[model samples]
Target: MKIRRANKEDVTAIVEMLANDALGEQREDYKLPLPDSYYRAFHKIDSDPNQELMVAENKEGIVIGTLQLSLIPYLTYSGGLRAQIEAVRIHENYRGKGLGKKLFLWAIERAKEKNAHVVQLTTDKKRPKALRFYESLGFKGTHEGMKLHI
Candidate 1:
């Protein structure tokens, strides 16, 4: 599979993978002619110099996975850059084929290219298997993550 920066045309496939799982089924609205919000969000992310929204395509050029990597400048880590990996999703039909690992390897390499001091991500507690998968990637549960909805 080839990994590259995502183009506008890849949004639908990205969202499809994003919505294929149980948690995604609750939070994502995936359909043909997706809501304009997805497009708007895509445009905003696309315009941001700090954000790299990526897509992975199979040999036939079908989008099979996606992730968002954001570079954040912060006072912590000695005023260094932090690469935040989020919204990682692999197409349902493509799971268990090592595409997720490939996607993550690409992201981590990109993070290193950007000179990020650290790479970080948050996963929902409901997904224990996902937690294990991330551990296998060499990520540690170093801190407690908290959030509040508006």
Candidate 2:
């Protein structure tokens, strides 16, 4: 398996993966039900310098996992930056195989290379196992994450 930066060609696969995830099903957050043009626009924005979309591919080039990293520049930390991880998903069949850890570590390394002050992510409160997994990776629940849908 290889972890690489995503390109336009990987958008469809990534969207499918995201849509099939638990949070995706609950929130209907992905543009999967929309036209290809919508995904095109999303891909364009995600691939910009300020944001990053990465995928984990097998030897045959199938995208089995994906994660998005957004750079958040902050003033409180004296111009420090943070990498916010979002939309992390692994293929259904590929769960329980440590692929998620691999992908996450890769993202952390990338964040370090970018001199990020910290790496952060939010998982749904219902996902207990996911919370444990993140804790195992040395992530702490430092703040209460709340959202209000507009």
For this target, which candidate reaches the highest lDDT against the unseen true structure? 1
Cα lDDT listed for each candidate: 0.94, 0.86
Show where candidate 2 strays beyond 4 Å.
29-34
Q: Give the per-residue lDDT of model 2 (tens digit) for 1-150.
A: 799888877877887787896667665455645566747767676757868888999888899999988888989798999999998989998989999999999989999999998999999898899999999999999999999979
How close to the true structure is residue 111 of candidate 2, measured as C-alpha lDDT?
94
Error of 2 at 84 (Å): 0.5
Q: Among these predicted structures, which one has the highest TM-score?
A: 1
Measured with C-alpha atoms, the lDDT of residue 16 in candidate 2 is 78
For residue 34, model 1's alpha carbon misses the true position, in angstroms, by: 0.7
lDDT of 1 by residue, 17-118 (tens): 888888998999998899999999999999999999999998999998899999999998689999999999988888999999998999899999999989
Off by over 4 Å in 1: none
- 149 Cα displacement, candidate 1 (Å): 1.0
